[model samples]
Target: MYKNILAAVDGSSHGDAVVEAVASLAKLTGATVQVIHVRPSQVIGGAIASTVVPVEEREESQRVVDAAVARLRGDGVTADGEVDEGLREELAAILIERSEALGSDLIAVGPGHYSGISGLLHPSVSRGVAKISHVSVLLVRSES
Candidate 1:
């Protein structure tokens, strides 16, 4: 019953599962997908720094979004790409904001399967998004 889906991708290994989930959902519901990649912004002096992003970072972000959009479209689903900066906020907050702004009915996110000390240091974005999101959230976890 979803008309529009917002898929949050980071070009990680788990990202593929998120895309697959979104593509299948879109195909079943005849919905369009909007793939987004949010780059974490640097903080300076307790505030978000508005510094110019390096060319390499921008290109990588674009590449992630482009690949996601291509995959969704290749599945015969209408799809588009977006790149955003999470300034002084968590990635979850940005995704929620974009979903509301885009009027998306659902949000698909991957946990990325962080493990060991790294997982403890870095909290799960999908968990945060699912907790605070106004719209429905689909947590796509990697099987491996």
Candidate 2:
């Protein structure tokens, strides 16, 4: 029942699964997909310093988005991509905002990879998005 979908990727193996899941769903529902990659910004020097994202980092993020869009298009799914900059902790919010801006009905993201103390220290992006998203969320688990 989805008319538009937003797929978030991190260039990981799980990211591939996310693309695949989105592609299948988009094709099934005739939904257009918008793929996005958020490059984690880092503050230089100190907290007061400006947030900086290296050129290489920005290029890599664009590459991730481009690849996902290409794969979806190759599968005969209409798709486009964009790259955004944000902190790791704010990924969920960024994705949700973009999804709402684009009027997306579904958001597909990869499964969380952290566990134990690490999991507690760093919350999962997918879980965060699912928790607060007004629309449907699909957590694509990697087959590996």
Compare the candidates by lDDT and give the number of the best one.
2
lDDT of 1: 0.84
Candidate 1, which ten residues in sequence have the lowest lDDT sum?
47-56
For 11-86, candidate 1 gives per-residue lDDT tens digits of 8878888999999999999999999998766444534644533323888889999999998888999999999886
Which residues of candidate 1, in runs, are more than 4 Å off? Answer: 44-56, 87-89
Candidate 1, residue 57: how far the Cα is off, in Å:
0.6
Please, what is the whole-model Cα lDDT of each candidate in the order they appear? 0.84, 0.89
RMSD of 2: 2.3
| lDDT score for candidate 2 against the true structure | 0.89
Alpha carbon deviation, residue 76, candidate 2 (Å): 0.5
Number of clashing pairs per prediction, in order: 0, 0
Write candidate 2's Cα lDDT for 5-124 as tens digits.
999998988999999999888889999999998887644576566656543467788889999999999999999999988866788999999999999999999988878996886668
Residue 98: error of model 2 in Å? 0.5
